[model samples]
Target: MISGAHVILYSQDAEADRAFIRDVLAFPGVDAGGGWLIFKLPPAEVAVHPTDGPPQHEFFLMCDDLDTQLGEFRAQGVEVTRPVSEQRWGKLTAIRLPSGAELPLYEPLHPIAHSL
Candidate 1:
């Protein structure tokens, strides 16, 4: 059965990035011996977007309030890569990870299907 999904982020400084996810983002996880951490993600949804360029995938963390979340992230020393912008589906922005990768974040304006 297709029960769940696992997403991996490749980082230059794996330990630091792991710490950021565990401590900063406060995702609950278990240490799989030798300090390997595996986190439990929140409810997730996926979309397929048509593109003309090379095939790729992207991930975003969804929120109920973008401004409040951004403020909390800023106070935690996280870098905001882009200001929030309105879209038909959501209010979107990007934040920099500890590995210097930009992660998209959004608050959906459209109906959510995660619970359905």
Candidate 2:
């Protein structure tokens, strides 16, 4: 039986990365106790070619208030690709991290939104 999977990101500045998720995006995270940090995410789906594909994983997060989230990211001076666009199943936006990595933030329109 599978227990769980934790997505690990390599960051040049762990504190900045943590700030981007916590202060900027306001993600709910907890101190992993020994200086490690963990951000809580909504239920997600993993794509088959995660490691072979982009630097990011396949577990796409579906945000309920994408506009609000995007705005907060903007206010924090976080670089966003553009306004959320309508994808086949959800709305999409990309945010750049201090580690020079781009992560996708999205909101689902189909099945509208079930979880966070």
Candidate 3:
């Protein structure tokens, strides 16, 4: 049975990035002893993009309102690397993690498929 999905982010500073996700983003998770943490993501959707080079994957956290979410993140001292830009699909931006990795965020302009 296909249950849920688990996504892993490779970090230069795993502990700091983990703390960012746990404390800053406030995603509830369970520590798997020795301070290893696994987080529960919100409803997720996947899409495959064609490339000429080797295939790669990307991740984004969906939100209802980009401005409000960005404001909240900014209030928590998170750095916003990209300003919101409108696309045919959504309003998008990126936030910098503690390890200096950028995590993209967006509010969908199209119908969501998370329930379907």
Q: Pick the candidate with the highest lDDT.
A: 3
State model 3's lDDT: 0.94
CA RMSD per model (angstroms): 1.0, 3.9, 1.0
- Flag regions of model 1 displaced more than 4 Å: none
TM-score of each: 0.94, 0.68, 0.95
Candidate 3 lDDT over residue span 18-44, tens digit each = 999999888999999999999988888
**C-alpha lDDT values of all predictions:** 0.92, 0.73, 0.94
Candidate 1's residue-wise lDDT over 1-116, tens digit each?
99999998888888988998898889999998999999999899988999999989998999999999999999999999998899989999999888888889999999997878
Clash count for each candidate, listed in order shown: 0, 0, 0
The TM-score measured for candidate 2 stands at 0.68
Question: Candidate 1, clashing residue pairs?
Answer: none
Q: List the residue pairs that clash in candidate 2.
A: none
Better of 1 and 3 by TM-score: 3
**Comparing 1 and 2 by TM-score, which wins?**
1
Q: Per-residue lDDT for 91 in model 2?
A: 82
Steric clash pairs (candidate 3): none
